[model samples]
Target chain A: MIYLLLFWEFFKIGLLAVGGGLVTVPFLFDLTEEYSWFDKRELIDMIAIAQSTPGPVGINMATYAGFNAAGIGGALLATLSEVLPAVIIVYYIAKMLKRWQDSPYVEKVLKSIRPAVIALILFAGLDVAKETVVDWQTAAVLVVLCAAMRLYKKSPFFYIAASAVIGLILKI
Target chain B: MVGLWQIYCLFFKMGIFTFGGGYAMLPILQSEVVRKRHYVTEDELLDYYSIGQCTPGIIAVNAASFIGYKLRGLGGLLSATLGVISPSLVIIVLIAMVLRQYMDNQYLQWMFGGIRISVTALIINTVWDMWRKSVVRVRDYIVFAAAFGLMWCCGLSAALIVLLAAGAAFIPDIRRLKK
Candidate 1:
């Protein structure tokens, strides 16, 4: 039943994750609250790893969550369920390219979904925010990250490394 | 001939090189699909990307699946999808296993705290970026504000918000077309 539920949840994500990969964040965020598949901090780590590693952010996340929840089979099943809809939908859309090509209706709908997705993503950020700020010193890390990101192009690799060192030194 | 092996190899290379997929992977995809294989036109790729955004699933994966299925039916689709995902599976599995060992270490916990803070910052930055990109018109501003308020205050599901926004976005277009 757990395996089936995982597949179903990801499959639904495949069906309605508008605006792109990160939009799936909100769905999985809700899942952590609803089920014990993985927790919010783990999801935040998954995001960091997913962004740093190769592959689509959404797929990496699903794979990580699936691996954590079940095992290898679960990972395979979760990924399969997630991409199955794409194969079906894209297959048909390719066939009917004439009807859908640059369809204004499609563009407008997507445009609208973008902001909604941003809102949802921001909400997910708050979940991570709760776990991230344990003390004033730890809270200081958040302030620094936010400040560094705003100032210049600090490569993620360097940024993460610096943060880890700060954390280790502060022991927060 | 661009056989299954070639398809697999090419996509696998893409999986390895392309970090932070979706729109970020577009240029590489164009080079591989359009310039190398001539599987689809640049215009066609852009079209697929546009539709991919509206459709379910990741845009990059959808684009890959579409191009693969276009070039070689089910075999092409399987090869490409597997190729793109294989790298992540291998890397993430290995990383997860190693991380599992250090899950309780105090030092690692502190590191995770910093990483999570960084992630939160990244996510918030992403929100601002998306907001700037999407909310151009006054009407768009209204929809965006309404969606945020409804979701935050009412605790509505993203699915419901997307559905409502989609309906609202298309209604004006439909009315104009009717006239």
Candidate 2:
């Protein structure tokens, strides 16, 4: 029964949280109010774990929250339910998109959407900056890393790992 | 032709590397998919992201499934989607079981803080790349400013902003067609 409920809740999240991973955070907050599966503090901890680890934060949160609710089964169920909506919806979108690939209207709309989407991504970056760029040390890290990344083309994993070591050594 | 296993492996690697969220996946995708593999062109990637934003579900997952479908079909879609989430399943479950106790440790917190800064830097780099690739026209600039302002100042949701941009672009097309 809890499995069904978990599926329903996360499935709703997948269906409604259209934008991205962080978009699901608010919905999870509401889950804290509705169910005793995970509390607000635990949610924060889950988010921290999700962000620090590799993988999509949304799915990570879902799995963690699900496990909290009903162990391994709950975790598996929630992850599957969460992705099911995406799998089904994007399948059709991809199918139709192929036909529309050459359409002038699709091209024109995509042309405009390209910039708008970039703006949204930039806005997301600013939001993260607001949270992470708290002091001079952190700001320095961001600036230096940005410059270094632009200069040398390396996999993102390399920089991420390097930053983790820097963080550990500096204890910042 | 790309094999389903290859699709799965690529996304699995992407899942392991991605931090933050879908936006953070952009750089990894740009490096791996566009640059290394040549499976999808840069424009196709942006297209997947744009559509993925408006669609239901996680953006990264949506994009993964989309790319998977384009590459192989239903099998590819399942492989890609499953591949990406597999890491989250294993890692989060393990952490939930054992490492929950250590989550509050000071050293880990400091490490995460540093990791967060790096993720931001990555996002900034992605924005630069997208701007270079996408924002060419004066109209595109206007749309960019409008979308950014609406989201930042007005607190409008991203889906609505995308719809508005698409609608605004569509209007001019209608006018051009009538002319």
Candidate 3:
């Protein structure tokens, strides 16, 4: 029953999280509230884990949520559920590329989705900021990173690594 | 069957090297998969990236699956998916095992603290880039603002919000059809 629920929950996430992985965070927040599977603090921890680790944040959270709720099998079920919609969609899209390649409606729909996706991305940025920028020191790091990105065009990994080092040195 | 090893190696490199996930992986995938390898064209990759965003799974995995399926069907899909996930699986297992002990360590905490801030910046940067490249009209601006406001202020379920937005988008078309 738990596995089925896990699959269904993630399937819905997969089907609807149209923008990307970060866009799923808000939904997962609501999901945790409803399910009692994990609490807000754990969700933060999952975010940390998901961000620090590889793979998509949404998939990582789903796996962790499933594991918390129902162990290994649940984890597998959740992961598979999360990917299933994409797999199916991509498969069909791949099949129909030739037919739909020149469709103006398709182009228009894609064009329309871009703004919504940008909105979703902005929401993700705000959500992460609320969690990470609690203090002035961290806030400074954010400013510096943003400047580096905008002004210098420095690689993001460099900023990430530099911030980690600064955090270690300053104990902030 | 054809050049399977090369494909696996290529995706594995992408999976391992990308630090910020999804958006960050875009350029890397574009360079290695599209420009360097000639596996897919830039337009196709952009389309794949768009579809990857709308679909579930890791965008990297979705991208890999599409590329793989395009190249060699099921076998390609499995290989690409595995390749995309392999690095993360290994890294996460190691971190999960070791991180609990370091949870209280000040250095580790500070390092993660810094990383968290940087992650926020990266996300903002990506968002800005997407907005510049995308959002074209006033309606687009309105939709973007509305969605962001609803999510941040109301803490609404994202799934429901997206559905409402999609329905709202369709309403005009539906009315036009009636006329």
Q: Give the interface RMSD of each candidate.
A: 5.9, 1.2, 4.1
- Show where candidate 3 strays beyond 4 Å: A1-51, A61-85, B1-60, B63-77, B96-99, B153-179
TM-score of chain B of each: 0.56, 0.92, 0.62
* lDDT for each residue of candidate 3 in A1-172, tens digit (9 for 90 to 100): 8777888998888777765556668878988778988888988887777775656666666667776777666666777787788777777877786578688766655555556556655766676689889888778878888878888765555666787898888777
Write out the backbone clash pairs for model 3. none
RMSD of 1: 7.4
Docking class of 3: acceptable
For every model in order, what is the number of clashing pairs? 0, 0, 0
TM-score, ranked from best to worst: 2, 3, 1
Candidate with top TM-score is 2
- Winner on lDDT between 1 and 2 is 2
Task: Give candidate 2's error at residue B150 in angstroms.
Answer: 1.2
lDDT of 1 by residue, B1-179 (tens): 56987788877877765455475455467556776668887545655665675677887788787777777877887788888888777777777777655556788767755655666666666556556766777767777788779977897755577678777876555456789
Q: What is the TM-score of chain A alone in each candidate?
A: 0.58, 0.92, 0.64
